[model samples]
Target: MKRKRTISLNSSSITTRSKTRAAAAAAAAKFYLPDDCWESVFKFVINDKSKFKNRRYLNSLSLVSKQFLSITNSLNLSLTIYNGSRPFLRRLFQRFTNLTSLDLTWYDRDLNKLLCQISRFPLNLTTLTSLTCSRVDSLRSGDMCLIADCFPNLQLLDLSYCSYVSEEGILQVLRRCCKLRHLNLANCSKIELHGMNFEVPNLEVLNLSRTSVDDETLYMISQSCRGLLQLLLRSCYVTERGVNYVIENCTQLREINLRGCCKVHASFVASMLLSRPSLREIIVPSLRHFSVTEREFFKRHICLVY
Candidate 1:
């Protein structure tokens, strides 16, 4: 006859055997707290602006019980994908089932494969990254469709320092991800002035800083992105005519950053003040010859001239 494993119900086992008792407690759920209640407590702990860090609190909670571990795992919605995280990608995704935003700036592996792995989960990606993606493989035009298909609700996309993101890929993104609002194409060297005729009707904030964007590109942007609120063209090749065109056409433009566009003159500030009365902020390359009225104007409006 096959022998069956038996549990020791002795006094010694009851006092000293932690594993058996812990397992029994978890299985029994004697004082089972509701998941939602635990979630609320966790949120309060995490959102506390006090001196104690939330990570330490969570680490302590995770060790309390299996239920606590599962609840903590579910609370994790954002993850930073790096080269070291590649091997444990499957396990990580399984643990953090409700992940949304992902930062891949530190990722140096195959971008396509990583994206494919991410696509398996329906994550609502909408956020930023401190570091730029210069090390990873360039996201191709074909991959844009895959990205849009997976994360169609993506509102904010930070592709800064991704120099090889072609204009066609951009067009693909605009075509598919219609809900896209904030697009960070900063330092994308391959973005040329010509053949970018697509419109961004839903786009609100655009960062084209340190790119090869010229007058024609600005003109195109002026017509296409009329609903645009903020335009960052810092260190771009845009001229006076281009800037003026944008100021005229982009009616709702609240802020414009021309801090490094050497082609734009200081005199254009006066023109901007006269033309766009609704302008809240204007980051100009240089400012001079400010009258008392102009100083008052600067005070009234938050204009930053550098």
Candidate 2:
């Protein structure tokens, strides 16, 4: 037997290599699941409860895995697109279906695509409550109607400095939004006294400072909105008649701003404030002197900061 065993170098080397290969295979087989099983391993990553830390983190996570990207992109809620972010806004509307609130303010007269995109919002018009439109000069009548029609449940509407909006556009909103309670039209140069005619039954607060409205509009408002509690009319064309109209009719009025209303007589305003104890704040340009009866009521809650 010993004489028959002839040791060959090639055969010996082959036997050694086989043992090493077997050991490596055994180690790899100890731990590892199939690809299908691995998918179910990270199921929590796709849940909507988990939110991205910040925008940078969101961008980074979107690149991590397909499941993460799908969930993150589907959960976008509030979106704000500034002047240069129009492209982002367009693409966002196309994909982001869960948008609840949107705020857009542009620097230039460029809202062609932005306005068009807003018309396609998926949610019911009655669900939206907040809106802020600024500096879209070419906005037409139809555009205003489209907006008012969409947000039938709008509670707060701020159209500050929207120069294109006329009486027609505003009337569309007043007619539709019965739930509207707060409205701000400061610096809206095109808005005249005629535009002030709105029947906001639930309206408790209003800001019409720096508009073209005069005492005639104020009188009309008192006759219409008896529930109006607070009104701001600084720097508009007003006189004693306007102030008198408000105090006589709008007894619920708690605060008013008459700053820079040079046409009004300070003495009359001082008298009205004393007569109406409900008047809490009266902002006037100047109050040189007051009658004894006026001083007693005026000093109650008058803040003459102007």
Candidate 3:
């Protein structure tokens, strides 16, 4: 009887140990990794060559756990929307509340409706620093004013190819968004600088490429944006006199793109290279009478892209 009782006790102990081992294995299989670990993994996954595949992986990760959803939301800093609907935009803003940069280039939608929807979410626009709404042809002065009102802390604004935005709209942005560091008004034909007196002291990079900007506009930019470093005036109406004015006033200018400016002579660019040691790049159209030696010398010091 004693031997049988001892065998039963030993068998019960063995069964308990096996159950504990099984429970430990199950717990290990369901272990949740830390958020930082998942973020590191996400970074690795996004480094893949295929963007679609990366997006798929990100979507899957977001659906895995609440922690993943939060990480994905914070990591999504820049977004590009093409012809987006109001409801879709609202959902995006709701998910990515900390979005810093947004690009709506070539959005073929109602400008007023989109702006109205964006205005409804002031919190989303408050943290936004960079905004690119290129080729928004319907963007008028009033629309620009609305943008300035909503996004007062905008540091970089690219309204390129927005031909409808007039001088008044441009002035409104410069005046309101005082923290603007980069402003692109490329192909904005109606933008004029006849009576503009406002200053953009922090403006470092300005792009007026393919615009109707004349010497007067250049002069205004030189006077107002004294800290101008990179200036793109490609296909603009600026003459050598205007370029000279910029070189004289914007002493900190590093790069200038004068491509397709037929009136700007290559000799003037060579002179600028000699005078402005800070000038690292000067992209001009092919020179007609530029000597090989002079070209080589300019190439050695600066990137003279033709």
Best by lDDT: 3
TM-score of 1: 0.78
The residue pairs found clashing in candidate 3 are none
Kindly indicate the candidate among 1 and 2 with the higher TM-score.
1
| Model 1 error, position 192 (Å) | 2.7
TM-score of 3: 0.83
How would you encode candidate 1's per-residue C-alpha lDDT over 1-306 as one tens digit per residue? 123223434645666778788888988797677988999989986895542466567778989999899998877666677889987877887777776566777877677877787677554333211213443456777666667766776777788888677788777777777778888888887686466577778998999999988999888888888998999998898899989888998898888898889999866886786677667788886555667887776766666433
Model 1 lDDT on a 0 to 1 scale: 0.75
Pick by TM-score: 1 or 3, better one: 3
Q: How far does residue 207 in candidate 3 sit from its true spot (Å)?
A: 1.5
**TM-score: the better of candidates 2 and 3:** 3
Candidate 1 residue 134 C-alpha distance from true site, Å:
5.8
Our model 3 lands, by Cα RMSD against the true structure, at: 4.8
lDDT of each residue in 9-124, candidate 3, tens digit only: 99999999999999999996789677788788889868876656766777888997788889988667667777744568877888887778878786868777787778877454
Task: In model 2, state the lDDT of residue 226.
Answer: 69
Alpha-carbon lDDT, every model: 0.75, 0.68, 0.82
Cα error, residue 66 of model 3, in Å, equals 3.5
Best of the candidates, TM-score: 3
